[model samples]
Target: MTPSEYGFLKQFLKSRSGLVLSDEKQYLVESRLVPVTRRTGHKNLSALIADLGPRGSEDLKNTVVEAMTTNESFFFRDKTPFDHFRNTMLPNLLEGRRSQKRIRIWCAAASTGQEPYSLGMCLQEDRHKTAGFRFEILGTDISTEVLEKARTGVYSQFEVQRGLPIQMLLKYFTQQGELWQVSPELRAMVQWRKLNLLENFSHLGTYDIIYCRNVLIYFDQDTKRDVLQRLAKQIPEDGYLVLGAAETVVGLSDAFEPVPQHRGLYRPRKQGAAASPRLGSAFPTLKAMNS
Candidate 1:
């Protein structure tokens, strides 16, 4: 692609979805957009770009944005966070919200449903503790294609193999030919919807926990700070925020501080405390878990 063409496509993606693409990602753009070109009957990326003008079809623009959004996910990704949730976070939240008897969780960028489903399973395991609590899991993503798949709660054998414990799989999934379907009980626990991190989230109510995960890596620092600030507003004082093991809120936003002894866990910065300095440096031990 020529310089002008590359710049146009990069800026367009950034404006639409907050996806920051650098010059080195030119090959990635070509590879990802080739199918868009073919489907739209454009000869190449240039033609596709040329057609995406002020008069462009909304559907066409959405298609391009969706095509570029990464949707990689699997069951119980990065065992540590789930471990913390099951052992620490959930129990704490359960006790704190005992009076209210309600628990709400938002899993941002919940591609293919695994992350939220995993949380559902965790809740199931601890059902005895949450006997009377009402649990709600909302999984949101920018890609409608993945949201549809997530709602179906069906996965191929290969998808099940990744990060999914065999025991949990047997307990929660029913084999259907080559694919494994999440049990009705578990599937019913999660609600999936289309959400853009760049857009207003005031319509979505506050949550006791929010999992924004690996999605922030695609944005520039400004976008990251803005997104984190917005997310902070949706979390209550004692609520938790989980980012990808490789992502952080340290330099980006002071709205959150790393949870002590938790790899990828964070909470809203305390009201009267100083912001944690260089908190991202403390996450070296956490590995990237975006599979």
Candidate 2:
């Protein structure tokens, strides 16, 4: 791809999805969009971008965006977050919401459904603890293709093997010829939708917890602050926000403060305290969320 084409595509992706593609990612752009080029009958990435000019078809734009968006995920992708949820966060949330007896969780960038399903499995294990409480899990992603796959709750043997324990696999999934399908009960526990973090989230209502792990790394600093601020508005003061271990609100926004002893956990900052520069102190062994 020429520099002009690369620049145009980069700007387009940033405007649409807040994805920051640096010069080093040119090969990544070329590799990811090759299928799009062939499917759209374009000669190359340059041709494809040219055809998708100003006032491009919404379908075409969506195709480009989905192709570029990374959807790497697996069941319980990071064990610590789920463990923390089960041991610490859920109990506290349950006690706090005793009068309401209701809980809502939003799994943003919920690629192919693994993270939310993992949370669902944890909730299923402790159903007795939440006997009278109602729980809602909402999974949202930028790609409709992944959302459809998530809705189907079907996975290849390899996909199921990743981070899914054998006992839970036997209990929660049934063999559908070669692939495994998540149980109807687990599938029924979550809802999937297409949501861009750059857009308004007010329609999704407030949530007791939000799992937006592994997503912020793609955004630039300004976009990160903007997205975090928007997320802060949607979460109650007592609600929690979970990010990828590598991501932090340190220099991004003052809306959230690190949850002590939790590597990737955060809560809305108190009304009067100034934001801390020590946000990075919470997670000393930070690594990429997918790694």
Candidate 3:
């Protein structure tokens, strides 16, 4: 790809989805988008790019980003955080929010929906305890393609093997040749949508917990700060915000404090509260890891 061509693609991506394609990623552009090129009936990426130029082609633009975004996830991704959520966070929130009888969660950057479904799987175990309470798990991502797959709740054997426990796999997923389909009930408890985190954060309603995990590392610092600020407004006063083990809100934004109970877990805090978002910084990270 010509430097001008590469620069155009980079700016296009950054503007549309906040994903920065480093110069080293020129090969990535060639490798990943060649299929898109073929599917669009273009013989080459240069031809595709020429046809794409300012043509009011929102669909084509969407296709490019979808082709580029990563979709990596699994059941009970990291054991400890879910364990903390089940043993403490959920229980504590259940008691604290008894008056509301509602527990809301958002898995931001929920590529292909495994994280929210994981939460739903756990919630199913305690469904009876919160019978009257409304529990909702919403999953959102920028890639329409991944969101569609997530909605279907099916996974390949390789996808299932990534951190999925054998017992839960047997319990929640039905096998069909090489694919594993998550149980209908578990799939039903979560909602999925295509969301771009770099833009305005409204439209996603407030939540008791927002799991943004590993998605933000790809963004620039200003984007990160702006996103964190926008996210602060969506989480309730006592709500928690979970990020990857390598991520934190410190020096990024002044909206949340780290919850010491679970490492790398965060909760809403007053503005200017120092290092509020406590991170044990352990692993299996906030869902599918960036590493």
TM-score of 2: 0.93
RMSD of each: 4.8, 4.9, 4.5
State the displacement of the C-alpha of residue 59, model 2, in Å, after optimal TM-score superposition: 0.7
What is the C-alpha local distance difference test score of each model?
A: 0.87, 0.88, 0.80
lDDT of 3 by residue, 70-127 (tens): 7767766666667656665677678778999999999998998888888887777667
Q: What tens-digit string does per-residue lDDT give for candidate 2 at 107-156?
A: 99898999999999888877887899999999999999999999999999
Instruction: Please count the clashing residue pairs in each candidate, in the order shown.
Output: 0, 0, 8
Question: By lDDT, who's the top model here?
Answer: 2
Model 3: what TM-score? Answer: 0.89
TM-score against truth, every candidate: 0.92, 0.93, 0.89
Q: In model 3, how large is the Cα lDDT of residue 83?
A: 64
Per-residue lDDT, model 3, residue 93, is 78
**Could you give me the TM-score of model 1 versus the true structure?**
0.92
